[model samples]
Target: MRVKCTVSYDGTGFSGFQIQPGQRTVQGEIERGLKKLHKGQEVKVFASGRTDAGVHAIGQVLHFDTEIYIPESRWPNALNSLLPEDVAIQAAAFIEEDFHARYHVRAKEYRYKVSRSEVRDVFSRNYAYHYPYKLDYVKMREAIKFLIGTHDFTSFCSAKTDKEDRIRTLYDIEFYEEDDVLTFRFVGDGFLYNMVRILVGTLINAGRGVLDPYRIPDILKARDRSLCGKTAPGSGLYLWKVYYDN
Candidate 1:
């Protein structure tokens, strides 16, 4: 049966979601649990996308084929028993044979969190980026206006990325503040390597008065990585949600 599962992880303890030899990865653990369930027979799990080290996720989706015949409702409980504390299966269901967690995704939402308080919260350190610098909220909002819609986001992606077709349709970049915390949510068809984090960093730079908001258009047109700002820390990033056409 084709099984679809939504998993959540703290990410602090994980190297990343992919299977890396000799590394403690989220996929490694999940595959380990699956093997345990299958009496040592290895099973592979496919994720929607890979998140870098220290990146968290609340609704990361994945799929794998299994023949254990466990009910969909009990999949979570069965997997949770074999998984580590940092990772947990939130929900699972038997999906169509053609349903793919990655290729079938129509859209995805990624969120980055920032704490602007002078006093740091130790508890949130592992989950949020502590950036107490003064940010012009109005400027950040204005900068994103240039980001919404389809365009080549080469400047907002890591140079290490090999994907040449950087054109992505950004549905929206939403910003909101709650007291001392700033939340930036990005909705889009897809993202390049570190694209959302780089975009957030560029927007934050605009808010910090280092870059002019109006220059965003030129930056996009430039297609130059040098025009981009610092890449935000991975801790602040989260795979918020994934949407499907079906």
Candidate 2:
């Protein structure tokens, strides 16, 4: 049997989602929990996407092939009992044998948070980008308008990315502020390495008057990493959701 699991985690304590030798990671922890349940049986879990270090996820989807037939109602309790507090299994159910968490993904949503305040809150320092500059929300929104729809996002990706096709369809990009918290939300078909962080950095630059709102079109046309702002901190990003068609 194959099982699909929806998980949520605070990534502050882990290296990242993927497992690496001698490094604490989300996959490693989850696999450990599975091992405990299955009497040391190693099961490989597949995730919808790999999040960078210090990045979080509210609805990360993963799947594993297992012969152990446990009731879905007991999955949460069973997994949580063996897993650490930072990682939690929200739901689990039987999935089609051929279903893949990564390949079948239809869309993904990521949000980058910024604390736009004069004084920073120590509690939120781990989850938000603290910027002391006064940001023009209107300008940021205007710049985001240029990001929606399909385009070559080469300029917004890390130079180290090996992806040959830089084209990606961004369903939406929006910014909103509530109190001292500013949220940048992006929904897209897929993202390249460090793509979201770089996008947020560019938007932040636009908000801080460093980049003109109208310059976004030119930036997209350039398709060069030098044309975009630096990649934002990984701590400020979260995998908000993933969508799948059937």
Candidate 3:
């Protein structure tokens, strides 16, 4: 049977979602728990996508094949018993064998938070990016208008991205502020490596008046990575949700 699971995690303690040779990671820990459940038989887990180090997730989804027939409702507790406190299985269900967590994804939503307070909150230090600089939200919104549709996002992704086709669709980009925290929510069909972080950084620059908001179209047209601003820290980013076609 193939079991699909939705998970949430505090990624501060993880190296990343992917398994790495000596570093602790979310996937590594989950697989470890599954290994124990299967009496050492390896269980490979596939995720919708990978999150960078210090990046959190509220609704990350994964799927794995298993011979065990534990009830779906019990699967969460069964797995949680073996997993660490930072990672959790929120829900599980028996899924069609052909369903894939990654390729079948229709869309994904990500959120990045910026703390505009004079003094950083110690409690949220590992979760939010503290930006003390003044920002012009109006300018930021103007800049985001250019990024609200399908386009080649080459200039807004990491140079390390191996995918040659940089095209992706942004369904929407929303910004809101509450209690000194600025949130940028992005809904897209797909994202390249570090794409959201780079976009956030570029938006921040525009908000700071460091770059003209109207120049966003030129930057996108350039398709040059160097034309974008710094990549925002992963701590401020979250895999908010994933969408699928049933």
Candidate 4:
């Protein structure tokens, strides 16, 4: 049977989502619990995408196959018992045999949080990026508008990325500010490695008045990695949501 699950995790203590030999990872933990469920039989969990190290997730989706019969409603409780405290199975359902977690995705939303307060938020140190510098939010919003359609995102992707085709469709980019917290949400059909982080870094540069908002188009047209700004910390990023059609 193919089982679909929605997962949430605090990525502070994890190496990353994918399995890395000699490292403790979210996939490793989930697979461990799944093996216990199958009485030591191994199972592989396929996620929609990999979140870089230190990136949290509010709604991550994955699917796995198993021969054991466990009620879908009880998957969370059963799996949570075996998994570590930081990782959790939020929801689960039986899916069609051919349903795929990665290829079937329609779009994904990623959120980056920045604390604008001058005071250090010790409690939120592991959760958000602290940027006390005065930000020109108005200019940042204007810059984001230039990235709201299909384009080659090579400038924003990491140099270490293995992806060959950099073309991607960005559905929208929105910014919100309340109190001392500034947030940005990016919705796209798919993302290349470190794409969202690099995009946010460039936008933040615009906010800091280091880069002109209108120059974003030229950067995109350049298609050069050097044209992008510094990449944002993974701690400030979250896998906000994964969308799929029923």
What are the C-alpha RMSDs, in order, of all predicted structures?
0.8, 0.9, 0.7, 0.9
lDDT of 1 by residue, 1-246 (tens): 999999999999889899899889999999999999999999999999999999999999999999899998999999999999999999999999999999999999999999888989888898889999898888988899989999999988989989979999999889888978899999999999999999989998999999999999999999988899999999999999988876
Which residue ranges in model 3 land beyond 4 Å of their true spot?
none
Which segments of candidate 2 are over 4 A away from where they belong?
Answer: none
Cα-based TM-score, every candidate: 0.98, 0.97, 0.98, 0.98
Q: Backbone clashes in each candidate structure, one number apiece?
A: 0, 0, 0, 0
lDDT of 2 by residue, 1-246 (tens): 888899999999999999999999999999999988889899899999899889999999999988787998888888899999999999988889999999999999999999878898897888998987888888888888898999999999999999999999999998788988989899999999999999999998988899998999999999999999889999999999989897
* C-alpha lDDT of residue 113 in model 4: 95
Between prediction 2 and prediction 3, the one with superior lDDT is 3
Report, for every candidate in turn, its global Cα lDDT versus the true structure.
Answer: 0.93, 0.92, 0.96, 0.93
lDDT (tens digit, per residue) of candidate 3 on 1-246? 999999999999999999999999999999999999999999999999999899999999999999999999999999999999999999999999999999999999999999889988887799899998999889998998999999999999999999989999999999899998899999999999999999999999999999898888899999999999999999999999999999
Tens digit of lDDT per residue, candidate 4, span 1-246?
999999999999999999999998999999999999889999999999998899999999999998878898998998999999999999999999999999999999999999888997887798899988888888898888898999999999998989889999999999998888889999999999999999999999998888898888888899899988899999999998999988
Error of 2 at 10 (Å): 0.9
Deviation in Å, model 4, residue 213 alpha carbon: 1.4
Candidate 1 clash pair list: none
